[model samples]
Target: MKKLLIVSLGIIVFILLSLPWVLILVGRNKLHDYDIPQREQLIPSSDSKKKVLALFPHPDDEVTVAGTLMRLKEDGHEVVLVCLTRGEKGKSSGIQDEQELARLRTSEMEESARLIGVDQLIISDYPDSGIEDLGMDSLKKVVLNLILEKQPDILISYDSNVGLYGHPDHRLTGKAIEKVFLKEKGKEGFSPDRLFQVTLCKKQVEVALKLSSGFQRNYPENPEMGLPQPDFSVRTQPYFDRILQVMQAHQTQQNVLKDLMPFHDKVPAWIYSRIFDREYFREVK
Candidate 1:
């Protein structure tokens, strides 16, 4: 009787100790996947030719952030695109092989650029699906060089952490961008301080969470691990449409997308109106 009681007590204690972790795990699982259900309002900008540079970790990131860029270009910003990786590991519909997929995505980006009126497209041969592996020193070297060469009035990239379980490439690029900026800011000279990036806001986080919950219902990959929610957002409708078009360009990830987003017909207009836009640096005068 004593041993049984002792064992039961031990088990109860252990369960009690793990209660917090279990609750956290369950809460996170509820938001395993999601998509942006809305669009942000485009803030007004000067109609002059403002220089802008966008650094993205993969082909689709550029497309993902497409709507806001569209607004910037429409506002007369001179836009430049820098793709950090070829996203060779990414899939495409109709295209069966890796080589073809890469080619198709590149072409798709070209189409995206044409639609958005981006003035320049630059790509680094960093391994596809391998941006998270970028070495700090190497990234710093490359980013610094690009900063000098582009001389952009504004620099944009992934926020420190994307609200959803972030893509490794996106997180790495975000960290690398901050490192590069910190290393270059106000130093002897690397042109003027025209660096900025788009960020996810709190309202956006709420939306992303709701969307992710829906996604989890379809594909229960890993129980979700919730991160910081968004607090800032930008709106770009036309760009959001373009982003959808770009996503459509990638057919293989249909399963992933299916899990992460709502059917187009079911998505609400208010969600569209409140879409999360890119977060970036403030334009230096």
Candidate 2:
């Protein structure tokens, strides 16, 4: 009877503590990608001569590059956001109607664009769920048209291994984009002659979170699933009010941001500003 009691206690303990650790371990590995090495800190210099184009899988991807976009725009570099989809599945609260949700997501994205002073917002007809491998011909055509229209000097998009972080759509989009970027690179008439990826420094994620107003709160399983800091970053503190304002515009993603959390929200604004860090890719010319 004593031995039986001990076994029961051990099983109970594993069921509770062991389960959480398993979740903490495998859950994190499955939740976000940790492949990219985040080491360098992005430092901005004088005004950049390059006009940058950021390609986002969804509306919120823009936030990942928000600081860089804000700085680039201020420094005389034109910035445009190309949202590949309307982000229809982002119904976190689960109260919104599906059709209404997609429409609302679009509106939210629009509001975000306005806050960023972004001149253009492109929403592709690609399905909300799968953008990476869908009609390559159609995607190429869409991207090609944007190249002609925006004439960006640089192109930015998700890392090639989008799925490592647990989102299949992200990876597929990466694949599709890789094809499109390769085809358009240096091809006459395609604007934005270069390409870059949105990366974060593993070491700087804490910094990224601080600068980002604590975005990406839930996926802490592998906080490293988050991208490393980009090699080049901009200080948008001068325009942080605008940054915070735009951040609030993403109402759907509110729960995802950590700053909105209880304890973090209480911190002073100056401190938060010091912590913010954002980065992205620059395609090889």
Taken over the whole model, the C-alpha lDDT of each candidate is 0.59, 0.60
- Give the least accurate 10-residue stretch of model 1, judged by summed lDDT: 276-285
- Tens digits of per-residue lDDT, candidate 1, 1-285, equal 999999999999999888756654554334222343332423345334667778886665665457778778767777889987766777534455877777766776666667667899986778876765668778778878888888876677765544133666666676677777776777765753554455443443455556664323432243244333333335554455666665566555554454334454355433432332243222222
**Candidate 2 ranges with C-alpha deviation above 4 Å:** 1-50, 132-138, 204-230, 259-264, 278-285
Provide the TM-score for each candidate, comma-separated: 0.67, 0.68
Best-fitting candidate, scored by TM-score: 2
* Model 2, TM vs. native: 0.68
lDDT string for model 2 (119-187, tens) is: 678887577767645665766677677777788777777666432233555555555566777876767
Task: Give residue 216's error in model 1 in angstroms.
Answer: 6.7
